[model samples]
Target chain A: MKQILAVDDSMSMRMLLRASLTAAGFKVEEAEDGRAALEWLDNNSPTLVITDINMPRLDGFGLIAELRARDRFRDIPVLVLTTESSPEKKARAREAGATGWIVKPFDPEKLAAAVRRVTH
Target chain B: MLSALATEPRTRRHTIMQGESEVSSDQRMVLSTVLGSCIACCLFDPTLALGGMNHFLLPTPPEGRGEDRGEAERYGIYAMEVLVNAMLTRGASRATMRAHLYGGANLHEGMRAIGSKNAQFARDFLAADRIQLVREDTGGVLARRLELQPASGRVRCRHVAEHVPDGRPAAPPPSSGHVELF
Candidate 1:
């Protein structure tokens, strides 16, 4: 099974995402915020990282920058799942090395397709 | 309904759901709810002392889920329309309407940004209907608890913390299953 790291501050959202991703056959690991996601990254190598933009402490952009700075995680695909839709925000994510962006309230199939697009 | 009505002697508090809306001419009637990614639009007419509120989870329902599913209320179009119609029925003139929008938080990371979409939909919906948007607090990471006084058109917003402090027991999750309020 492919391992994927899911990061979000909302427990309900995490539960929904986990249910969707697990149903799609991906093994999912969850972190509540960017800082916790970094902690998880220290011990685990996920095939892909799905992250939300706005978070306490470290945010999605900060996480992407931190990951890109490290050689081990440099090439790993990072997809931003956030409620932000401004063109400037999307540009910033791309500049920070995000592989793709998906707006929130995603269904199972849309999420699975995005994962497949980035990982495969 | 009785509890909300009983409290009406002083102040009436109404907690509405995703597809639900309420309109009132009473200054003591306060409408409130906690939102994750959904959008709540509050409409009020100063001249008529009429106010209304609606909460919507999505901009539009899924393609195949038709009106018979009773899911239309979950979409912005239906929610906004219902609110406007209710206000009109209560003697609010559309020409004097003003709007205040809240919610649309990106509470969950690594998922579609439904909150932003909902907020955008609200702005467009209001604009298309020519309702002046007087106030807005939307698009953030924190979930919010919002209260609106329809008659006075006053609003209060409080940010909800995402996690309980270390060693503290978390609040019990809301019960699953449909709860019908009569």
Candidate 2:
């Protein structure tokens, strides 16, 4: 089973990601916020990570930076799912080593394509 | 400035009309808003006109409940569920209810995290709860002043800012001759 870590501040968002990924044939895990996501990463290394930008404690930028700076997680694919369409945030995310970016309210079809594109 | 104001017809009595008592054979709700950093989402059941809204600030609620049955407190999960459940209690079915969402604004600077989280939060909640989002207008560079008409399931979101998302200071276009049937 290709393990996928879905992280977001909203349980609702995580629910959608889990259902969509599970229906697509991948094992899914959930994280309520960015800090929790990093903690989850410590224990289990998933093939792909899908995260939202705004969170309670540690935001997505912090999570992505932490992941990118580490050699073990450097190769893992990270995708940002957010409502921030601003170019400033997008540029910062790209520089932080994100593999892809998808706007909010994403469909299953779009998610599948992103996963395919990022995951080897 | 006072000379010009004195010439106008001083309208003393502002029109104040109350709405219908929320009644839904199925699930319907009523809600309130608070806090500048937070965005309120009023999810209504189109069939029943019964739903509720929550003012969510950060993405997740303070930890302790641990996704157990007590998760009804998490902003993203709990708040949305509470609104949905409020409608379901009024005899509305979740499957048939069409979600009408409102409120996603950038009220503060570093608060970009909150704005993004709230927008994604609402969208994901509806998707997870198996509810269909009939209409959505979110993530602008302004705060929202909204009112939910339970009778019609119409959520009017007014961008309350001197500027729009495009960096232009403009009032929102008038709401007329437009409908999103999805």
Which 10 consecutive positions of candidate 1 chain A have the poorest summed lDDT?
A102-111
Model 2 lDDT on a 0 to 1 scale: 0.58
In model 2, which regions exceed 4 Å deviation? B1-182
| Residue-by-residue lDDT tens digits, candidate 2, A1-120 | 888999875566677678778977889999977889888888898999988776657878889999998888997999887645566777888889888777543546557767866775
Cα lDDT of model 1 by residue, B35-80, tens digit: 7788889888988777888888788767655222345556676567
Error of 2 at B59 (Å): 20
Candidate 1 lDDT (Cα, whole model)?
A: 0.73
**A116, model 1: CA deviation in Å?**
43
lDDT of model 1, residue B176: 11
**CAPRI quality level assigned to candidate 1 from its DockQ score:** incorrect
Candidate 2 has a TM-score of: 0.46
Collision pairs in model 2: B26-B91, B26-B92, B27-B87, B27-B92, B28-B50, B28-B51, B28-B87, B29-B50, B29-B51
Q: Write the per-residue lDDT of candidate 2 for residues B38-146, one digit (tens) a residue.
A: 4455555555545444554445544533222222233444345445544654656657777655556666687666666777877777776677777766666665555
